[model samples]
Target: MKQTTMNRTQRTVCTVLAAAALAAGLSACAPLIVGGAVVGGVMAVDRRTAGTQIEDEGIELRAANRIRETFGDRVHVNVTSYNRQALLTGEVPNAQERQAVEQLVSQVENVRSVVNDLTITTFSSTLSQRSNDTFITGKVRASLVDAQDISANSFKVVTERNVVYLMGRVSQREANRATEIARGVSGVSKVVRVFEIVSEEELRRIAPQPAPVTTDDTKPSGG
Candidate 1:
């Protein structure tokens, strides 16, 4: 009963956080979803190693800082890193700024590669558009959570200009399944996959192991 109660609390907390993020319209994109066993379940089911996760976070921060330092408010870019692969989205004034932004992100420490999807547009996305994108991101995340067959936590979702960008280490089967699900969401104009494809065997190899249960009979004797 206690375990069940804890699970319910965790879910409620995650739901509230997700709602808050949506309301704020933060650029971090997808609202965190509670999935699988418990809260923090998203990170638990993530394919990246703990070290890789830290590195990815650092890559994003450093890249964003570099872009801001270099271009100031002239260019609008969103850097999302998964498995050390950095994805650049949003708008730039021209082709030259787009290439420059990509170069800056690529120079960030530990970035394995970069996918530049920045549109060459003079005008950046407006507040209303960004709000809609945030809404779309939340809807897509919720749909992924609803799908029992595929692990929603495996994918990192980002939306810009109504295009949904998916990043993760997933098998072809999982990638296709996620794409279909993302496309079915109402506000998604397009879905761009940035997945690092792995074999099912590889996925199994990296899957999180279950914690060992301790019984009273197996308790170690005190010294």
Candidate 2:
């Protein structure tokens, strides 16, 4: 009977020891999993922030201007961010309405800036330029995408009167490269850079691409 009791105690102790070892192993792995989750969350937030930073501010200013032009000083206009860039679409009632919207947006903080592209046409049509505006936007966006030197996701582009407005957080080098690319596009007559550099990634992405080389066979001999 004593021998039986000893074996039972030994089994219980071994079970407890095994459980403790398993717990320790899990404890060690928990941090790595947790660390990965934290890093992923941060990256997602940054991308969201970058995406909305210019666009929200842009949409807000555009909405405010539309309201002010449509409702006059009756409505209060406020702008809350910069990652957003605004393109004034549709028709304004008069010249006063156009200027009023511009002035209001100018005063709004975090407004990368405003483009008063509103046409002073008759409201008879109520034509939505959203699609047209989107087409121009896609053009500039594709141009930016083709050139790998800039973080295409980091920019908010708006086009007005063939002028391209670039808004985002980027290094000076990135901003310059962006300007150059926009200027080179066929429809772009001018480019406005409204940018702020926030990190080193901006600097790294803006380095120019190496030029292509040609062999002697491909090039004519110099006279």
- Which parts of model 2 have CA positions greater than 4 angstroms off? 1-69, 72-95, 103-132, 197-223
lDDT per residue (tens digit) for residues 145-190 in model 2:
5565665645667655455677666767778888887788775667
TM-score of each: 0.81, 0.47
Give lDDT: candidate 2, residue 54: 49
How many steric clashes does model 1 contain?
0
Each model's lDDT comes to 0.84, 0.55
lDDT by residue (1-223, candidate 1, tens digit) is 9999999898766655654443343236544432223333333377787788789989999999899999999999999999999999999999999999998899899999999999998999999999899888888887776676888768888999899999889999999999999999998999999999999999989887765787798778998
The pairs that clash in candidate 1 are: none
Q: Which 10-residue span in candidate 2 carries the lowest summed lDDT?
A: 35-44
Candidates in order: C-alpha RMSD to true structure: 6.2, 22.9
* Reference-based TM-score, model 1: 0.81
